[model samples]
Target: MLQLGGYFKLIELGLEDCVSDIDAQPVYGYALYKDGKGAKLFYPLEKFNSDVSGRSFHNGRFIQKMREKAVTLPNVRLEQGTVTSLVEEKGTVKGVQYKTKSGEEKFPMALWQY
Candidate 1:
């Protein structure tokens, strides 16, 4: 899928596979998935006192640098969901039931045919 300006591979969709042609973030947010664990894109919100000094507390300078260079994160959406069930018909993999922000919606989804 494409996002912002880059793209990322949707290795899997929950447990039921779903491939998309739309820009990733155009559909969802950002996060990371590995080893069956889910991680969200969030950095710590630091606090500073008026007496504090040294490096700037907000180190968003890195993000600023990337923006300056026109470099950006890949287009990937947070698959914020879990597979509830599989829709099968006559032993054929038909569709999937997944939970999104819109609750569970089982639409006819097939990659090869999509």
Candidate 2:
């Protein structure tokens, strides 16, 4: 699946059968928040002391790196499909339900959010 200018090879909705280890490469960006008065506040990510340098955080580059690393793993399968919905129990998310060209299915999702 493609999202946020990045291409994702989604087998499921989670990371259980996906990436082994992920590194935190902080990217600098601004978040816009609106107040009750309709005034917008622009918060720069770097100012929050997260140590983001705005250097190694290119979307396309990151996606390419992930794709490269994923191919090197054993028994990794990338399913071409569309996520129909998330399987949630109470307040916890269990997995995801997706639909491919063949039919609909479900898998144990290890990761839920980006």
Candidate 3:
């Protein structure tokens, strides 16, 4: 289910937990998941950023630099519910229904359908 899909984000990418060089961005912490597993958070990839001083993302040192500091995350979930029905008004879909850990809820929306 870990398909790396393309999407969009509208905010700044924050720093993550890593032991990078002084010039590199250092990771400050970790993220734990529900299964007692964890992974290092990193600065969201900036396609334009680079370290021309080094091997340009080819260096293997970065691998060991991370494994040496492996972390653990537990009790993590992305969302509480699956998107339920898409409500329709006239020809436009205008709402969404969902059930969370607590119960059900609805969110009204402007619609777009193919």
Candidate 4:
């Protein structure tokens, strides 16, 4: 898990520091049931040891943290808008057209290149 986190630069971004016991919890496993019967299956995280574990977190907070970190980087723009359409060229997506409070805007894919 540490190696995977490192690959995504989570360590460099100090994302681990954002984890709090209040929002992040350890989830050992889950049970599913149907028709008021006992759990049909018991899925444990430890069984898939190398892939993922029993860890739970608040998605909203995690996304907020990512957005906060993203906006701090050069050439990064965080806009509050709804994507209206895709800008396609030669059968490929080139950019996006979005609507904001004031007006509509076009964000080309080229602008995303760093």
Please give each candidate's TM-score.
0.24, 0.38, 0.24, 0.52
Model 1 lDDT vs. the true structure?
Answer: 0.40
How much is 41 displaced in model 2, in angstroms?
23
Per-residue CA lDDT of candidate 3, range 63-97, in tens?
55444444332432234366677877797667666
Compare candidates 2 and 4 on TM-score and give the better one. 4
List lDDT for all candidates, in order: 0.40, 0.47, 0.40, 0.57
After superposition, candidate 1 runs with Cα above 4 Å error = 1-80, 101-112
Looking at model 2, which ten-residue stretch has the lowest summed lDDT? 1-10
**Per-residue lDDT of candidate 2, residues 19-112 (tens digit):** 2233434334344556644444333443434432233244565565566657677856565567887878897877777778788565645444
Q: lDDT score, residue 54, model 1? A: 19
How badly does each model clash, as a count of residue pairs? Answer: 0, 2, 12, 0
In terms of lDDT, the poorest run of 10 residues in model 1 is: 15-24
In the range 1-114, model 4's lDDT, one tens digit per residue, is 123333236545566544443365644345677788756443343444442323466777766866777798887877777778887879977777777878867564342554
- Candidate 2, residue 15: the lDDT equals 30
RMSD of 4: 6.2
RMSD of 3: 16.5
Off by over 4 Å in 4: 1-9, 27-54, 89-94, 107-111
